[model samples]
Target: MPTHTPPHTPTHTRPRTPPDAPPDAPPSAPTQAPWQAHAQPDHREFDATLDVPYRASPGARRTISIYLSYPDQGRRHRASWQLELRTRKGAVLRRWHGAVTLGARPFTLQRDWDGRAAGAAPLTASGTYRLRLQARTGNTVITQEWPIALGIPPRLAMPAFRPLATGATHHVATMTPIPTGTILPSYTVYYGNLHSQTNHSDGGGDLAHCTGAQDPQSAALGPPDAYAYAQAHGLDFLMTSEHNHMYDGSDGTNPNADPRQATALYRQGLQDAIDYNAAHAGFLAIYGQEWGVIANGGHLNVFNSPELLGWERNASGQLLADTETPRSDYASLYSLMRARGWLGQFNHPAPDQFKVGATPLAYTADGDEVMVLCEVMNSSAFSHSADESESHRSNYEAVCDQLLEAGYHLAFSSDQDNHCANWGASYSNRSAVLVPGDAPLDNTSLLAALRARRVFATMDKQAQILLTANGHLMGERFANCGPLALSVRYAGAPGRTAADLTIIEGVPGRNGAVSELAHTADITFTPAPGEHFYYARLTQDDGKLLWTAPVWISQQSPSLLCAATN
Candidate 1:
């Protein structure tokens, strides 16, 4: 990590924007007129969410809430959805269904669950129960799942969080070491997938029939197999993130499973990845774990971890994972991640998930340091698109907007959560990682690029996008109270041209919406007296989209500014 000097801000009078404007040049007005929004997203998206306790006793009362937000008329889901409590055997124990309250502001649908089967029948099990919530939109299914502990002893209690938006100043001290060396340097864009699964746990099958979650460990392919597949498909690198719990041999349903076997399998996965990377000169094969579940919790891809993280144990109470970040305890996980210099991605997120401190998408200084990318889009999980024609995809850019606005810095990544072992082939989308020149196109540099947030999510593998502010590259944060200039650089394969491009600005910590500041590729504007972040977005004529990580800058009040000088 390296330190940087803050540029001087001329305060006598706000310097005119476009400082480079020729003295004899015509006057410059605001470009396309930047607009204002309070808490909406930079892109148009709709989302539905369900929140409930991660664990509840068999008969204890529990509360559940369903929320619908960000209305889009054209791609609207039926207001109606269903909620069901089911057994590991897939038998429904209890069920509920209804329409979400329709309004501009996101609203919640809540009810009490008494931990019993429908009609008061006693649920006679003390194991994990799956709570499934589902909704139908035009051609998509919006669903979420939460693992409810019926009788198991509590490990990570329902998380208690703090609102990160208001506590922005507390994290000011942690926003340093933006980049290790020169802020801007010659670089090359390397594209790859930071997520996907293999046979180590519920993935890895031939592309012909790898259409969905295969039985964990049932495939002839594993991490090395996936790496070979991705390399053949022209991916720069591929990480096979196995589900941690699946190491127990029961997809997280067998608590008494052997802890020794779980550790052995996890360690072996890491070794296999290391071996593959060593043998392959140009392609990187990474191994990590997809930690956590859906519903009350969200999945995070943990890379560079020494061992698998888990909460389950054998009947003898021995831990399964040698190194454990308590399951569902995201705060603890972030702290540990920072301590270990481990980087991760917020995988397939929704606004209502990943509630850190204040609310979902809220900030945590540790979270700010640990999470590098947020998956903005994911190709269809079970699609057998051996080619790049997979049109079914889910958009999570709104989640990215919410996280950035809430003060956690992250780059955008488009992933293919390959449950069917079809690595890099389900979609054309790729996470374009920008590595500083002179750095090797290996695991280390690729991970470094992610840590620096010098990355973008693109639906076109060959497209390139980067954002810079004040001559600083994307994923940069600094203190400024002067003319803030922004620029977008993009290129596409031989036949493609950018159809639309825009600069989007948002008030970090505003917990509000972002605005399209301009359509120009370059613009200079005076920033207001607060924290702000800006990003670049462009679309191709075919509707393929790409996004860059944002540049963040904060303005200090006079009192704080003077104290610093003294």
Candidate 2:
């Protein structure tokens, strides 16, 4: 993704203060100093704060809270200030001019702003806008700026649902049938980008309004724009997991004093996603949020929930209560998500600057089973180099190994984790869902497939993998009786060939060991005893990678190691 810098040329100005006006306070000095001298005062400084709503519906009255504060020097001084609201392209949208007098006491002023131009033109397009404030006294001028996003929620007409194609020609021998009683019996692969962001949260880019030219400050696309981008770029599904707290304005200071207003803005984001999903057909849009706290637990992506769960904090930065779960306990968070039938996945579990906590490796079976998936590949910028040294383990892969070692049946997924506007086509990390050919491409089928763990993740957009053990699919569990037959099949991306394919066998309480599986497009194997789970990892000539979900092997009588279908 390229970075853009917004142009900062002021196109509108207003002189709110008269030059001859006396200071607001009585002068303590016998004579007035030159405006230049007043401006040059080392102690004379001001700060401006803008409180803009995270989002707004079209034609709604959006109020911006502006706060300006300056230190008191026991002397009265006169100054003029101007505020300008401009589009991302530097087009002036609104301007306000005013004058103020500094008294012996520190001066603090709060003002409400309605997004409108001088001619009553409403700034309604969805995109980023610049809010600039300038304060001048005695010829010296200082300015500060903030970014504001405005747009109407997306509400497109719904398209009719189309059933998946079904025919003998559409069937792939390697593809397994959906578990009995599932939505569809036969399945095909569907690809999508699962994680990304927009202006609704901390992500940059315009959602409702696009200036065509990318503004450096707001270059990321919003939910609706991102969905459109994904569909246009050949993706079958899209999910935006913006930071959960960004919409609530919970900064430990009750900054957004009106919680109702903050909640409204939060719901607006959900509504926009629902609207986009409703308007499109054959393309699925999943609504989710990245639940996180930098100091406590790392980030977790929650999908398919009916309501937005918020963690409210008090002044001391302690959790007060979550929107869904009244208690502030960490474990209860997962409990609440499960109670709402949401699927949670650990996102980017590496120890990065933004994430600090015990790795997913520390998760125990007590109640952590709700977290079913791990993000093995995140963002396009991740390093693709492989390390043969056992001690040099990557955080993501290490966590996946630990989960299997701990006896947790987890699935694998890869996402763009995109903050920019690229959406589905950024860097190629994607989740491929195996849905029945006649299954409806909607949220129910998608979520059901995910819950069933019928999926694979790939770093190459065009890569696909199919695995079956004794007629059971990836994410299924069966007993390892006699010889456990496993089949692996793969398809490479354009201009790329599979360089290596390895089968990894994992036993409870032991590290997973990789076996020298065949490098060909298809292979079969009968694992030795004590192998409780199996998965495959394929590396392409182009350095891309694909990982299938592990199939758990148990000693239960229902398990059967049948002959290979081929």
Candidate 3:
């Protein structure tokens, strides 16, 4: 069947947020306040859980444990704790208020119930529930909450598709199997702000929030259709970074003035994703929001814990976990997310999208951070020329290059930023994560790999861009550079049955400047000393060319003499 690209920008407009709902919601649990006193910097821990096989016949006690971790010290914080359980439909299921020992500082906290609700009331039907934790020390709240999932029975519920949080990263797809005894690597992509018909400034989608909730057309193409499309097109995962009307006030900076309808729609979209995931297993969707900051270039996406960040905004109209600080910008958010062990990345920063500057990498202080990634491909900018698209891709590549040059760690990815399915026709099956086709496509495993700096990107076609150093498949690097030995492959039936490979290189540091390196049937690029970076493009005999992100190179030579001179 012939496919058409979804519209790059939605035509229908949505209404601005109403004057009621609180603009800034509280920051979710996992995204804790940066100032929560890490007195024992080693005492901090991140906990998560999963209960996928929740249905176990009748009278069976289904249970899952809260996975714990202390990235610092190897101490266990196992002690008495309290548990909170909520239903999939957003209702309090039961609150187990008691002292339960955790035993291990970084261990799973498991709880089993006899399929009962409150007061020993039997849970009439089998389903799913959300579990959260409150760790305390001498009546003091040590941790706000540790979110986890529960498996009740009959598999009636599934988790929601969350959007990437501020400075977060993401991905989707399958890959070839690696030889035995050798470990294969995976990649992640992150994106958001897919407004189908909602008010460009406010209005959250009305129906599942996949599109504009206010627009009937968008409402019709809700979560189910998105899920079906992903599964049919071989996509591994999809995420929605819907704008929070509550966070973006009517005036653009009022956190306490979001309309009720927008808030309701955001709430509904998250629920829809959770409900859809329950039925479709491998094809996953995540729930997240654009935290809708009103600043010139301040738009941060938040995911995972929705309830905690309910109405957490400040006078300046920016998201305030507790109080505002110097690092309130994108880089600061990245730093905070990395410190807390969450994946974050900088979105597009061009004049049309973010209007911040030519590049957003300068915002990151010290230029040295851990577990961070950047957006190389944004869905909104796909239709632009190859040179235009490469600018953003180069921005991310430059960051990756700086990190590699300085010995710090960073990664790369691409995102649809699909507000609706408007751009799907051309970009159909375009965005994806390169994970081992055999690995469990579950949230825990995929998310862990994503945070570990493993990912790649395809701008608008299936162009193969491989990053290897010294013949070793280590983690990815940002920009295309010399001695990097980058290989790009493109294979698609654009118009003709056969395809041709071409190398596209940008003008050194100027992303917009471009030149053709070579046009050949050969698929590999052996970089020369002056070649900064190179990407492969495939064209059909009919003349349709597909572009891929560049494999960055270093200007310095390998020998000590050349390296010392530069």
Candidate 4:
């Protein structure tokens, strides 16, 4: 047997061949293939293959080799190529947008991805994703995509930064309610809806789109139903943010179709929600709208506001609706929102729903009108994690982690975006804000807390955690030093002890890298250093915790560096 042992083929490496790929003509493909549409040519059939490395280590860098070969006049043209790597979530994890001149043959275009958002700052969590590619030569488009796994483990070594104080303040954080009211920042469930739907004259279908149809999740919860649901849930207040789309020219039967109709409906819906809240003693409805320029595929939101602004779209053809294509770009919409004197936030976004081409493009520019708070977690969207049902909830946390890593004013929310009216049966109202229900409810009290950005989103309604820092308290404060000073006190659902918490701080970068200041076991740092930001990662006696909004030296500082800025 030993003498007869023949040379065996090495099994470790094999010739990798790509599977069959659909043509670029599929309507749902990533994009227009970077080429203008053209009638099919009789002799032109397009096919391509790319060997992409898989199972990359977390925060690691790798390259892919794409073989481009096509039959032309019985001759084979070949070239090697590469493309950029982004977060499966479609964030520009790396911005190595590489392209090649198709006229050159057998030449490759290389893309180097550093696995960082905005092309810097190494990522923290690791996950799997797909690499989508599209190539075009005039009318000929080639599309290729492949699966990839990213596994970035936690780095044992922490970064260097000045530590901030981490402890609870004796006093509770309070906001002056509008129109003279007060609400405690303690309670279980808070409710709200995306108001653009019923408020408009045309009765827009869902918050996901402006089309008129029964909304999928929230439409079922009409006025009466919502009131009953709030009572059952022990909810003290409900918030509705409708689009200001009405122009005030038509009645309900023959609602106006003009853009003004949307604004008008928004105002009317606000009134209706307020009236209903007033009628119901325990329930209150706060007024606001998800206002944005519906141009250029961008979405921005103004949470608490009455009067809405509609901008005239210039020659560029932009609309600020939260649709796949806003008639206006980020700049126009941001400017309009800022000019109108409003506060806003970027909405829920995840990996599967929008891989860049499927929804309104994420804002990449800088501007003042960008909302100070980013909704890191929202029930409106699904997470890309293995758990599809709780993806909305899980993705919310994941988003918070990412934003914290990138140093953004990330806040958690559980909005219904309630277009259909059924209480987000599939998606959970997981992220929620706690408020005082002791006194008579008013929009001013609830909204004041929300606008101050002191809130947390949770998976379970029975769970609650409160945080504060150095006598100047906020929602949930993070204790990162000496005795890890901060409060992890909770209410409801007894039989729990020892609040499990993880605190993170955002640190600026030197070489364009985004990262957080390392967490410490004790809370001994001085509170006077007004540079770092802190937020709590609180869990119950049992391992259930919600990520609260960042409490920092200046809440508005991070907005300056936010990607949402136009």
Worst 10 residues of 1 by lDDT: 1-10
Poorly placed runs, candidate 1 (over 4 Å)? 1-184, 556-566
| Highest lDDT model number | 1
Tens digits of per-residue lDDT for model 1, 1-566: 00000012111221112222212332453343111111111112345555566455345777776655433323323355799998745589889876533323334566778888999887766665667878654333456654455664223111121111111111221211212222445566677888888889877876666645677678778888899999889888898888876787665345467778888998898899889988987788889998876545678899889778987666566677888666567898899889989999998886566766546666889998899899888876655677887644666766678888888888899988887767999889998876655566776788788888888899898777767777788898988655667767666766666655668889877888888787667777777778889998776644577898999888555565545653
lDDT of 2 by residue, 120-195 (tens): 8765565445667666765444444444555532221211222222221244424233222123245767888677
Q: Between candidates 1 and 4, which one is better according to lDDT?
A: 1
lDDT (C-alpha, whole model) for all candidates = 0.69, 0.55, 0.38, 0.39
Residue-wise C-alpha lDDT for candidate 4, range 1-566, written one tens digit per residue = 00000012111122233333332332453332211121111112222334455544445766554433232323332222334455534454443233332221222333445555553666666654446555444344444444355563222222121112111111233432211122233333353332223323222233243212232222333444544544454554544444322223221111223443444455565677767776777556555554432222223456555655543221233321222222334555555555655556555432211112332223322332244555543432211111213221212344334444444444556444443333333243444544453433365555555566656665445454444444334443333221123323344244533233456655411112234332322243443322455665544433334555666543232333432532
Cα error, residue 327 of model 1, in Å, equals 2.2
Superposition error at 564 for model 4 (Å): 40
TM-score of each: 0.68, 0.58, 0.46, 0.51
Across 132-164, the per-residue lDDT of candidate 3 in tens digits comes to: 555453222322221222233322111121211
Better of 1 and 3 by lDDT: 1
Count of backbone collisions in candidate 3: 75
Model 2 C-alpha lDDT versus the unseen true structure: 0.55
Candidate 1 Cα deviation (angstroms), residue 359: 2.9
Backbone clash numbers for all candidates listed: 9, 10, 75, 73
